[model samples]
Target chain A: MDQGNPLVEETASAVSSLSEEVVRVEGLWKVYGRESKRITSDKYSQMSKDDIRKKTGNIVGLKDVSFSISKGEFFIIMGLSGSGKSTLIRNLIRLIRPTTGRITINGVNITKLSENDLLEFRKKTFGMVFQNYGLLPHLTVLDNAAYGLKVRGLPKGKQYAKAMRFLETVGLSGWEDYYPNELSGGMQQRVGLARALANDPEILLMDEPFSGLDPLIRRQMQDEFIEIQDKLNKTIIFVTHDLSEALKLGDRIAILHDGEIAQIGTPEEIVTVPADSYVQEFVQDASPAKVVTAGSIMVEPEVLLYSWEGPRTALSILKNARRSGAFVVDKKGILLGVTNINRLERIIENPVESQTKRIDASAITKIPSVSEDTILEDLFGIVSANPYPIPVIGENRRLVGVVRTDDIFETISPNRGDQND
Target chain B: MIDFPEIIRIPLRDWIDEIMSWLLNNLETFFDAVGWSILQVMLGFEFVFTHIPWFIFIPLAFLGGWRMLKSLSSGITFALMLFLIGTFGYWEMAMQTLSLVSASVLFSLLIGIPTGILMAQNNRAESIIKPVLDGMQTMPSFVYLIPALMFFGLGRVPSVIATIIYAAPPVIRLTNVGIRTVNPEAVEAAKAFGAKRKQVLWDVQMPLAKPSIMVGVNQTTMMALAMVVIGSMIGAKGLGMEVLLSINRIEVGRGFEAGISIVFLAIIIDRLTFSLSERTSQNNQSHE
Candidate 1:
């Protein structure tokens, strides 16, 4: 993995904590209908969901699904309708019991729990948001947000105080007294989000929470949700059919096909290195320019000019490397500016440089630099207007790599063509 | 087909009669306690409805209509309808009929809602109760009067019992349907939030089902009012008694007066309850 950038390194470190599993599923299978347990054996293992359904009159909702989620990870389960993404999410909370499987949340096997214990476990461990905004039509916004707390038997004053805080977090402070039907679709989902957060459960399950909102509002909500997730660091298992949404919001996405996982990887891997044709086709419509970051495409410069180096040395290094320009950096590799052979040649001819005996500040040209995390779509204007290669800056303005306009164009062209087709 | 049916005939009526006789013989005390409680509730409602002067009742009806329906014209219309009932010379009888209908509806809701909730919660309970509800609804109103009279012995108690049997089906069926059909997403959301089964019922299902349940209540009230005339056949008194007396005496003008008064009362009650249902349902529509 390219852990050259701070953002990627941070995520890489977060992913490294395999020991801190918050939720784990092993061989989970959910078959709907009579004698569902009988179909989980090897006799039906080779058969497809439809074939098994025809044979035993059982609808396979999820088939041998297995995965684990780290704490504070944003895991997305992406699939079309009937692909069992919803079923997987419901099974995580044991809302829909698995026919044959084990689901261990925080090291406790929820599948083995009694009904009463499951209820108590659910109260403490899970908070769910639905696409339909599942707010009670009769309750006010504040009451709806406070519902999870109220159901947990929290005191009225404490419940409202926590609910009020979460309501404000989701930007629904002034709308507390309004009923759900009185709000717009976006505001209703905010209340749904707030209600889930008010519980402060270990896991937040969202089933296409933005699917009901208008497209523009959906984007706005996704942005706000990303910010909120960053702040809260709650483990969220989000289910959505929207591929771009998975790419935009998910730290890692598991694409489900026919009740089984087709592929599970980070968005860049899913986009650039699809595990199979199914995943490739699933990600076919996703625009790479929007998902591919500068760090992934940028090339580390071979010839780097140190600011202490004289203009003669800078020009000689650029010449030997067959490069027209070089990014100028301090000894610590913090990006100062860009310098070219022409500029260095002009500096060597000038007597003003001999007094300092080093490369003059005027020899380096200040051009725009982008963080390694900036997506290619955002780099279009900056890369197009600049004459020099854009420097890829990391944490504390350290120059890690450089992105040429060609890199952006090369990364997006095939994906754009695929989208057009 | 050639007089061969006698051997194949089923003794359903005899069986029912035998069961009825058995119940009447064995459960006398149970029947008496039930009858006495129903009679007390009916008498209490009758006392209040009859004692309130027409002057005070009519204004109160106007105010209730105005507040509930939120229209001055509706208030005036309600007062006018009650005034017409008074002019029909059956004001006290109308109060008696009102009390009977109120008592029947109250007991119907008490029995029907819980039964509905049970049916909503359990598929087996629903399947068992559904056919019984269907029988209660489809059986002729006169069929229950006989059993009710046999059980409670021909008076207001039997009349109220018969009216409850006649009218309770809609509420039971509608309550079952309402709770069962409450938004599944809302129910799922409640469950996901760790709400217990009881919390899911009261917090989400019951509130969402309010409009449908209110409609059921309206239907029950209307059905209960319809039973009043039939209830008179078994020695019950009210506008129904007047109608029964007019029928017995062959007095067409007097029957018409009583019938018109019943119609006036139905119109007022129906409008009020219908508006109540409408208001509840309208509260759920998107104001945005």
Candidate 2:
């Protein structure tokens, strides 16, 4: 509505940016049982969650939780069952009211919305997919998907067409007339996804959507969910107790402990640089290689040579750096190849008049390298087979850094001087 | 042995009678409106039942039973049972009894379903109505006749009222239980989707609670049928009156014939309703 006003338009465009903060929660606390309001005051606010529970027979569901999520980001809230992950997520969507604190979404404080306004805002802005694939048993698949649109007062024809499009997007085009009970769990979850998407809400709230699924189906569903998220790019606030799921899907992960946020960061950051002992213990059993990336472990290449540099020059650089290999890149930093002292020595010793090459022909293109975005786990075999350090290539085949086998070994046993250089 | 307590009387009946009199006096027009509506429904059912020839009604009943139960044997048994009642020379009286039962069940369902829905929605209403439903179920059926007579006087209307009071509780209680017992997750899903209160009740609650409500309707219909014989005591002419006349004359054969006819009618109605409820409910559709 304010598209014409330059200042208003700028702010709107800023909010629409993928990296702009969309959802912000400040000092949110939800305490259950008698006189929950007391928890907001000085007397109770200073007490620990357990102490408050013991002193006043109250259950702390959330405690002083504050975080802000960017637009189009897959933000995962991870915790154990009683850690208030669900309570926090529900509070975000206003499904469960917080005892005290403010939740501002797109700059509007949702905590202050009246009941009617909250419902209206929820209908317009948020679509939730539940853990149990909450499809109405009486409605057909199409009707289930169309339910949100119907509630929002879309015309009957538009609701059907939109629901059909969403169903097709979720790969459920033919099962439109079938009731939810007739569908498999995975299929029902697709319907749930479709239902949420059909409403065209700005944000998606998913509460353990794949938890009820078996391992095989859950994996498949996660792939499908990632694919859907890529296509739709909706701002998602996903809640899960499974650390693996959080690590797999989250662009940014928030770890909750005892109704309070332990840490919030990217998956790599959470795994490699956990904020506290709670988060460290939480991610201890999770496979680090799944989230550990080449870029995170890569170091500045000790020896690099211009492609124009002859074998003798490359040899000196590798020898000085105490390395077997040196990467040869063009002047623009695009990778050409790697040359080692052994290959240079062989070329120097076997220099025939007809074979006047600067470097050994075999070493010119045989070097194994990986992109900066490649996960370390994916290069396990590649890195182990090669004696030379794996060159970490960045955009346009530019040699950015190198990952040594020693670095890989150190990353594996993280407790030994566990500082990321 | 307890004659010493005669001085300390509990005047519960007096209190009830006073309340009843006050209700009758204060709400005369309301009662009259209700009585007129029920009488109209009764006459409508009576007209159709009495005017239909035995051949048409019998075949229709057989067809309904066959289709609803999906069994030929049950259908034949139902047809034969109706035929046996017909051969007893009480077809007219059976028709009258059928009309009365139908009217009573109609009103019971109409009143009970909304009351049940209300009780299911409101905890306070549930707590208040629960004991009242229990009393309605457990009280002597004859006791309802006193209030019915006092309110509407003796005739078909009073008998209908008495039968309704006796028959209505099962449907109300079952409806309440049914709606309440619907899966909370499904209700939560509806709420999460932004369904308004009325939309949630109609679209989610009612459909899921339907199987239980059907069971309630079946029970109510059977209870209404049970009230027919007692309803005859209030001067409503039917198969019950025939049984009463046979008892007065001490004719065992006549009484047996009339009694067997009543049994035949009961079996027919019960089987029909039970099978109908089973057919309509999607409960059988969901195996697990």
Best prediction by lDDT: 1
What is the C-alpha DockQ of each candidate? 0.64, 0.47
In angstroms, how far off is A198's CA in candidate 2?
A: 0.8
Best by the TM-score measure? 1
Interface RMSD for each of the candidates: 2.1, 2.6
lDDT of 1 by residue, B91-154 (tens): 9999999999999999999999999999999999999999998888899978888888889998
Whole-model lDDT values for every prediction: 0.88, 0.84
Query: Tens digits of per-residue lDDT for model 2 on A338-363?
Result: 77777777776665622543443455
TM-score per prediction, in order, is 0.95, 0.91
Candidate 2 Cα deviation (angstroms), residue A180: 1.7
User: What share of the reference contacts is kept in model 2?
Assistant: 0.38
Candidate 2 lDDT over B20-112, as tens digits, reads 989999999988888888889999999999999999998988897788888888789889988988888889999999999999999999999
The candidate scoring highest on DockQ is 1
Clash list (residue pairs), candidate 2: none
